[model samples]
Target: MPVKATREQRVGWHAAHKAACGCRDIPASLRPDVIKLLRSRRKP
Candidate 1:
């Protein structure tokens, strides 16, 4: 049987995705939009 990915592997994958997204620079004029969305969302 093929080996399955562990929980840590899954979490690390999502963490990498989030970090990649955070590195993207939001336009200064639109930063508030990003801030509002982040504030409204709960942590996973």
Candidate 2:
């Protein structure tokens, strides 16, 4: 089985993802849909 990620790893991943996407603060209009899309694609 795969190991679970630690809190620090999660935080680092979010930071890196935001930096790479250049969307640290997604706008209000797109926030909901964007988050939904992201969650839908999240790997288990």
Give the winner by TM-score: 2
Q: What is the TM-score (0 to 1) of candidate 1?
A: 0.41
lDDT of 1 by residue, 17-37 (tens): 444676655556545554555
TM-score of each: 0.41, 0.46
| TM-score of candidate 2 versus the correct structure, residues matched by position | 0.46
Candidate 2 lDDT by residue in tens digits, 1-44: 11696644544455446547855675565556556656766799
lDDT of 1 at 42: 42
Name model 1 segments beyond 4 Å from true.
1-20
Query: What local distance difference test score does each model get?
Result: 0.51, 0.57
Error of 2 at 14 (Å): 13
What does each candidate score in C-alpha RMSD? 10.8, 12.0
